[model samples]
Target chain A: MSVKHALLALLEQEPMYGYQLRAEFEQRTGTTWPLNVGQVYTTLSRLERDGLAQGGGEDTEGHVIYRITDAGRDEVATWFTTPVARTQPPRDELAIKLALAVTVPGVDVATVIQQQRSATMAALQDYTRLKRQATGTARAELAWSLVLDSLVFAAEAEVRWLDHCEARLRRAAAELDVQNSRLTDGTSSVKREFRRSTGETHADRTRR
Target chain B: MTAVLQLTDVVRVHGEAPHEVQALRGVSFAAYAGELVAVMGPSGSGKSTLLTIAGGLDQPTSGAVTVEGVDLARLGQPERARMRRTSIGYVFQGFNLIPALTAAENVALPRELDGVAPRQARAEARQALEEVGIPHLADRFPDDMSGGQQQRVAIARAVVAERRLILADEPTGALDTETGEEILRLLRARCDAGAAGVLVTHEARHAAWADRVVFLRDGVVVDETGADRAETLTEPAAR
Candidate 1:
């Protein structure tokens, strides 16, 4: 999802200040991809370097603005011509945690979720301390603050989800185990098993 | 195998009266099953327009376009649209997702429209979303996703419809280097899944993604190259 064209896509309409661009981007997509002012400006510079855009000149506040060029418009049109299909969010740590939860016999899903919860909670604590301790007015420090905020929120969200997952996994353990055995052995016959439960012959089931 | 799409001297005109524009002119091309072809051209060269006609979403003003062994001009508009909904999966540039719908809902829409049960449709959507690696996002709306994430969700939606032919205008047009590469890889994976896809792009980088690339010039097919192809073509190399 780390596509610079996201910013470029917004720039296709008209020139905008970096701060304005960031705000518009967040508002338009509901902030699915959050960006700091620095990240926005850095991406703008790269786009300018790539000849996809040119600076639109600064306003009274010294904030530089940008607009998509003919080349950039061409790029945008090209961008629109193809269908974007991202099926998978890259490699998520959660995927690995869940995969092993079932494959490793006796490996407790609840325990794994708890382990992640505690680790993430600890990390969130450190982020909190670092965010509070920072007092400098440096631009870099302010930028770090935004990143830290994102990290803190994400860590907190994960811990919350892990707790919910632990409860669900525990409650479903017995039933999941029966299903799990059939799934693992690859012997769950859809027709035979369904007929056995319904007490109907295969021919009768097919007729119905 | 039947040619999935065959365009013979097709033309598409837009606008009327005081002004007129020809998006396509005497363009001819063919796509076979199991083929992944790239459509390449400069802006306004009409590659996207041509793809829409080939996919049966737009009608040609003159000449002929035969899709799925049926003459497109022969089919009624409603029938053509149904054919498109069932046979063609379009990956658009803007990711045109339904913001109000959950990721799974978006993926299951075509099926629901085709009258599949909501529960059954959702089950299929879940599988498709899982195939694309965002099954967890099934409950989230488009607003809650990243650009790459939204695109993945869109891809799952496109494929989940169970369409056999894909007409992608620029599957990676909006992403950075890494994300674009990921998109191209996924599109290629679609081809490996026994579905044929036609990709249109201005970048030569994606020329590798197609079994063939049909370069367009002034709305005409100029050159056709296979995968692993390199040619001077007297045109500047695509960046």
Candidate 2:
């Protein structure tokens, strides 16, 4: 996710041109997150401008090589030690869909949840299959497997969330059924008062 | 490859007149040798109905259900029961292991019921249990083993006599995530080893283990696609 830090870390190993940096990054990460040539140049230029990297003399092929500055090394060190922050979670589309589905009257919430669950499960299977195909002992394989594992874990969490949503919706429907039956048991007015007092809170909980 | 199990224009209607429920409305499906096809649908969408018809546990109304090119309807009740015992394997969500029997005994029960020698049935059961990675649990009773282990035994029972058509209904429903995946892997492996499998599951991830997915809705085959495309089909479209 931090392309700058990744580029900086790669540059720390040796002086390299834009293309070499891109190749090295992809090689190390197993090309899971490919780095484009233009993006590499842009990041390199930013690094130079920010005093984190300096343009070195051209190589024999007239390609401009870049070397990491002391500041870049410090940044890479810090990035490696810091844990990723989770307080401000990324806006997940599936989460947003379910949240909207619960409150929207016309939406088929069960279908929405089931569809998303299927998608996440497919992704999880892809990850698992990919993991099985990757049989390497290099550090790149290790790095790539870690990245793949993160995706697998995220997809697994998504599936569990979808299952929870389905269960909650079923519970809500059952409760609604129970309320409807009570309404017909000659306690309509009393039941209406209870619903008015507590239904709002229940609705809020369901939305969450 | 020839389909080991095929349902042609299968229609299964329950009850009569006003109370009749068309659980499967002209549904046609097939599972070829060495292929695992997952059947997915919401509850009461005829998923179980489809699986039962395919396994010959239930007959379809005004349609054909064939296993290994043999029509199930043409067979008498006794022969149909024999077919179920020797050629078809069914795994349920409940594990469905006989608590009174040991794991090996439960697995061997199907083969023994088909008139296999007790010694031979037990040997085949042990081999099946070993394939499921739980050979040591063979002597353990259903109540003595963990849920995952019980499910493995159930799977062993399903495949004990080398049944070519395996039908599973939410086989991984009761297990933890890791164990569920393990069970799916076993099913996938079985299909790879020349068995035809039909898995009825609500979970898309489990279906990913299959070669193809058949989506059902309102007792109809809504969409049939490769497992890889399942995610794209479910993606939210632009309104």
* Clash counts for the predictions, in order: 13, 0
Which ten contiguous residues of candidate 1 chain B have the minimum total lDDT?
B227-236
Candidate 1 C-alpha lDDT tens digits along B1-239:
55667789998889985487888889978766666777866678899999888888788889998877789788887888777767778888789999889999998998888788999999999998988888788999999888888888888877885677778888787887668757767777787677777899866555445667676766877556552222222122673
* lDDT tens per residue, model 1, A104-178: 898867557645644554565456546555546765466566666667667767755665675567568878898
Second chain TM-score, each model: 0.90, 0.93
What TM-score number comes out for model 1? Answer: 0.50
Return the TM-score for each candidate structure. Answer: 0.50, 0.71
Candidate whose lDDT is highest: 2
State the DockQ of every prediction. 0.01, 0.18
Best model per DockQ: 2
Model 1 has an lDDT value of 0.75
B76-112 per-residue lDDT for model 2 (tens digits):
9999999999999999999999999999999999898
List iRMS (one decimal) for every candidate. 22.9, 3.7
